[model samples]
Target: MKSLTLLITLLCFLTFSVFAHPPEGVWKKKLVWKEDWVQIWKTVKKEAWETKWKKVQVPVWKEIQIPVWKEEKVPDWKIVKKPLIEEREVPAWKEDKVQVWKKITKPVWKLIDVPVWKEIQVPVWKDIQVPVWKEIQVPIWKEIQVPYWKEIQVPYWKEIKVPVWKEIQVPIWKDIQVPVWKEVEVPDWKKIWVPEWVKMGIPGEKYLGKDHEGWEYTSHDLWRKKLIWKPVWKKIWRKEKKQEWKTEKKQEWVTKKVEEWKTEKKQEWRTEKKQEWRTEKKQEWITKKVQEWKTEKKQEWKTEKKQEWKQEKKLEWKDEWIQVWKPIKKQIWIKEKREKWVEEKQQIWRIEKKKVWATDKKLIWKDEWKSYQAPIWKEVKVPAWKKVWKPIWEKVWVPNSHGWD
Candidate 1:
């Protein structure tokens, strides 16, 4: 009984509880027991007996143990225990492949132009002064006196004295110029004589007798021639000369010069050579400046990549259950042996820790130094020639004056 109880206690202790699979990469422990007897119980309640006069009821349950047995033959038993070791070739997990990239740089070269300046010496010409002498002609004047003659007329008058004669009348009385004489008449008696002889008578007797008549004597008157004288008056005429006054007129001449003298002016000139200069324009070439631009590409390296790794695993396990009954108090258990099976699994992963750096194709730039040659020019000063003129003065003589002489 004690052995049976010991066996039952062992079987109860070996009862197993199922559990989920453990996490990866962790260690786990499991329990196992080998035994044959099983101990179990059932619970029942006791009821009270009833009679016609009274009935009784109970509410409590009680535990009870019952033993069962089967008739079978006892078999021989042996302990055979072995550890499960599985050998599986886990193909290496596929490793990840990574591509690397990088950048690179390079250098280039070119040519260009540059500017430069230089100076040169030049020459020039200068002018100077000079003096000269010359002669010229001029005008002069003088004064002088002159003489002339002329004629004129004169007038006069004269008077003279002379004698003149004329006749006049005169009256006069004369006394004793005419005498009145009477002559006596003693007549002719004596002259005439009668003859006496014839008469004889007495003279006396004739006288006395006128008284006596007789032949008487008578005296007779006689006429005879005689002379007479008388006085008379007379008128006379005579011629004489007379004096008178009268006037007279006459003409004369005058003279003078023709013109007068005055002063005058005149001018003179000379010739000479002179110096002069002139300028001209010229053309030449000079240097100039220009701008330029250039462009290029360069490359450099700058990238890194990592290698990949993964783990592989395999599992092997065995399971068995058995039961048996005998007519005696002894129990029995059995185990069977069979072929082992192994499972296969594969995984792929990359190891992120390992890395390597590599250069990629890219553009790179660099500057290069070089030299170029070109033509050079310099300006130099040189002497030049031009046309010029020079001037001088001189004097000479000439005629400029003319007038009446």
Candidate 2:
């Protein structure tokens, strides 16, 4: 069993070491670089410029034959007229005799029957009654006493305690100590060189020694003096007083007087007058005038005039003329110039270049071979896993009353 376990452990260790790092002891070929001089052919382009001339058409102004206008006036005839005397027949007015009707008016007297009326005075009687009023007396009203409730406030005296403070002096005694200085003669201490062996043999409580060669210093001694202090304090006291106040409330019953009145109806005697009317028949005279008309014969004379017309011969002068339009010829002359665009040959010079591309190889640098280290890769073999049936025994904790342990 120990031998088998050792073989399995050794195999696992070898496998882990082989896969964790790259393999060594492998040879590889590398390229070496070198420099040399060489020649090559390359293409190049060239350009050449040339001058040429071209013909173009241009516009110019020139003198040419054109139609000209001239202004000229011709003679024109017009008709004229003069005044001449002539005779014509026209209507005129003349005095003539004619017979006409005339009307004349004359006054005439006539008689007719007319009615007239006269007015007279009349009297009428009627009965009337009148009413009379008199003065009267009225009674006055009196008041009585009534009972009601009213509220009023009652006051009382009260006593309360209040705090009051009074100032007073209190004596406090305290003992205080004050520092007092005094001069004394003392020996001053100073450091001196001592060997380690000598310092070790000396006691810790013993000092080195006093300087005896006039090197002593003067010092003072400390002393305390007794003192007493007294402080002042004040005390507070409480006191009470009595006070009186007046308060009102609505809780009282009182009586008051109110006035009330009533009205009574009674009959009284009065005087009044009444008026009465009656109708009566009686004769009365009234004056009235009436209008009447009658027919009568009358004569009136009037004169009338009429309009008359007659024909008479007379002489009148009139002026006449005729209007005629005649055609007249005129000529107008003007000076002008003309211009046109003509096709003419013109020489224009320009510069042109021809490009020729040629390939020429150039040798700028030589090729070089360099040597460098190259990495070499190798295939590694891994062990394949196979299924093996075996029993696995594991220790697991079974839960009990206590926690897992």
Best candidate (score: lDDT): 2
> TM-scores of the models, in the given order?
0.11, 0.11
CA RMSD, predictions in order = 99.9, 62.7
lDDT of 2: 0.33
**What is the C-alpha lDDT profile of model 1 across 347-375, one tens digit per residue?**
21222333332223343343322334433
Error of 1 at 180 (Å): 99
Off by over 4 Å in 1: 1-329, 335-356, 360-366, 379-405
- Per-candidate Cα lDDT values, in order, are 0.29, 0.33
